[model samples]
Target: MTDPSRRRVVVGVDGSTESRTALRLAVDEARYRNCLLQIVRSVEMYEENPESEELDSAVAFVRDDLGFTEVSGLVTSGFPAMALLEQAADAELVVVGSRPRSAIASVVLGSVGSAVATHAPCPVIVARTSGERATPGARVVVGVDGSDVSERAVDFAFGEASHRGTGLVAVHCWQVDHPAAARWDAEAFATRRNEHLRWMSESLAGFQDKYPEVQVTTSLLEGRPAVLLTELSRGAGLVVVGSRGRGGLVGMLLGSVSQSLLHHAYCSIAVVRPVVPSS
Candidate 1:
């Protein structure tokens, strides 16, 4: 368990452009949240080095360029995902970069990002690019499916929107019977759309009330959830979603949409898992 009193943000560094971008964002987030910053370097078994220049440079960037007072750096040995999860056990958020350099790199990095997002105890931000900037009131989009898992994502989205003083777009996507069938039965399509809108409204009602200052908009669309959300992410500053939903398999940790966005989303993504109540 993480220390209860200390709040920290951890960033995994691997000397890639994505990792550097993740480090910068972690610094900005830590500064905004007024928390300590931790830079974690993951090394394979035979390549572990105490005097790694990349690690040193990352720490230097925080201390010199950013002027973060409480910065800690660690060199952990193992797979990057497992090392990060253990090192950031007490962190408020774990930040990682997700751009792949090659096909094999894509498979490797994708697995790392997906594993950490699915199993991490806290929130995980997968930074895909170096130039994503959010103004004071930019839009933050979240996917909702009216499940307990999605409710947690809604809560995270609301809190983020409230903190940034931005608007929240809650998207609920449903499939139509068929395009040809819908063309024939306009009334049936209308009824189905209305039902989805109603469910979306009810799912977001509490969040709207809690964060009254946040401008809330609901989108009910007919398409694949992943494609729609990825399209919406283009105009959004951040995309948030639950690890799984109603359609997820009983034994799977991540749903298709969440997993898909982790790799394809242009903007930063947050994969929020359902909160497990402490025993």
Candidate 2:
């Protein structure tokens, strides 16, 4: 196991505009986590691997210009995804950059960012918001459905809110039969909504107690999970979600429902994975 004191926040940088964005976020993340920052640049093994001016210069800039001397850089002989996973074996988090249009599409098409997010040992944040960048005070939104995976997501969301000192939005969405398919009375309809709301509230009660300082808003809406979540988090800095959900906002990071928000949400998204245990 890696030494706990040497915890690192890793990012893949290839001198692209997106990679630069990832590097910047990684720098802030490392500082926030009080850990080291690592930037990995990958080149094919068959290529001339030695003496990359790009990597050297980028590293120099991160160290000198950025005033982040605790940052380190690595040039590896492999695909970028493989390099990121190798470095993230013991990392606290791995950050990858992508444009909003390409964020999850690249993942579906088996891009490096998707590959790393799916397989990274730690949480992976794709720094692609519809906006120019994420703001510090923006609330952190989380999608929940009361499943074990969503529970884990809530755990991470609470920690994020507590640390960032931002409000947390926990959204749970469910749809009754379509209006055309079922005719219901106002009282019955209201009763069903109340049941769902109560359950959603209970799902978050434990987290609420644990993070008393985190102001949380529970969104129990009757609509498509992805649509509601996307609209709710329009102004959020980061929308966190479980890799899978219990028929809620996120089904699978690569699934249709999750892809909707991945396609439209205007904020950075963090795909939280199961915490990797230390040996």
Candidate 3:
């Protein structure tokens, strides 16, 4: 059981390099937010000593390395996704690692990071195993698609930007009909792209009005959404996206674009979902 009054951040660790990276990042975030850090390791019910001594060693390393004062480690027996989702119910944020599936897996079989990001009750951070830059301040980037999810993403991005006192960049992307035209009509596309940029600006106007202190910029590109988003993520400290888009099943697993971005995006990605109304 979790205490509702205490702020908590849950992170899943499985000993993978990506998972280790996520654990380190989670520790830093937990320390910065002054929140309790809950480390969860899930294993099959049949496995003996579920989270073996090795897992304990890793948790100890995180505690010693990050100097985190408030930390708890738990070993649970269940499916990874289910265990994480249950743990996330009381968390302010949940962090997980991205694992690429083999070629035999279905195209829709997104990494566990994507699945948890799509279904967790709280905000999910999908951390990749990339080297960190010694940047002073974090950058917040939000993906916009004119849907409720996108709106939530915008809200999360702005809120984070305000919290971190960093810049917020709103990005939208579209596919080009002709490959040649994509290069030839760069200037013409700029004008059309401005329209989309304007739309994003208008969509996020309320957030701007609410958080007047946050600096924000918008970009619209004519290309594959995932590709463009991943490219923009290179310089961002945090990238935000909705669990699903306009075409996805609401309140379900992550949609295509969100799923794709989780694995390939350069920065730490936050997946936001709409608030479910109580019955």
Candidate 4:
């Protein structure tokens, strides 16, 4: 049994392929953080409920097969996202999986992953399984735009990099809105790149001392931030980006850049929202 006082990694599973992937990643996260793992499956009213056997088997796999000691499971009644949000109010991290879908399916079926990432009080990771970025040198890549939420993302990314004993890559993108309107100057381009490099380094200033073991690098690319990040994700163990907290319909509709990365990034994506004061 996990202590109630300890901050835990919470993951919701529904016996789907996506949830299973989320569970595995959650286990690894729990192990590294030295915290509890709470596996939850919510059975909404009038809907067919998941078998308790599946939850038991998952808990067993973590304890017996995976040999992770600090783990537990719960089967509750409610909307899946609401149930998860309630449990994750004080969690260290809340994880959910993105549905594998075509572009249209993504719009039609608003993502639970996206929902939780937006409204959860803590940072949320929309975990996915990809082998391309799981190499020995794989780094935790973070998008840095200097927003408060992006700074929080930098903190989460540095912690993740330290936990994995890996490197970190801070990526920032700057592009001229319209090429035709602006005259292209190579010298000006170099100066802009150098400025972004310094800005990225400044973003890491606070966290570098906290995680000195992590080898960090900055990538200042000239392109769309979303597109560059998606391409970078192909070689990173994890890609972390920031999303602002907005309630209601606006919250449900993910921002354009995050929407693009969530759908196209090759590695697991973590959408971190800054922690807001309750008072």
As for candidate 4, its clashing pairs are none
Measured over all alpha carbons after superposition, the RMSD of each candidate to the real structure, in angstroms, is 3.4, 3.9, 4.2, 3.3
Better of 1 and 4 by lDDT: 1
Taking all chains together, the TM-score of candidate 2 against the true structure is 0.83
| Per-residue C-alpha lDDT of model 4 across residues 1-279, encoded as one tens digit per residue | 457898899999888777888888899898888889999987866344446777888898788888897888888887889889999888988989766434453562245776787688777888765535368758999988877777888889999999888999988877765555445676665666687788778768779999999899888787778788888888678898887422213234456667777777777888877655555
Score candidate 3 by TM-score against the native. 0.79
Model 4 scores a TM of 0.87
Q: Model 1, which residues run further than 4 Å from truth?
A: 1-4, 46-51, 100-109, 130-138, 177-181, 247-251, 277-279
TM-score of each: 0.85, 0.83, 0.79, 0.87
After superposition, the stretches of candidate 2 with alpha carbons farther than 4 Å from their true spots are 1-5, 45-51, 102-110, 132-136, 177-183, 247-253, 275-279
Which candidate do you rate higher for lDDT, 1 or 2?
1
Residue 72: error of model 4 in Å? 1.7
In candidate 3, how many Å is residue 192 off?
A: 5.3
Which residue pairs clash in candidate 1? none
Instruction: Compute the lDDT for candidate 4.
Output: 0.78
lDDT of 3 by residue, 181-268 (tens): 8578888667766767677778888988998999888887777777788778876788899888787766777777777677666677
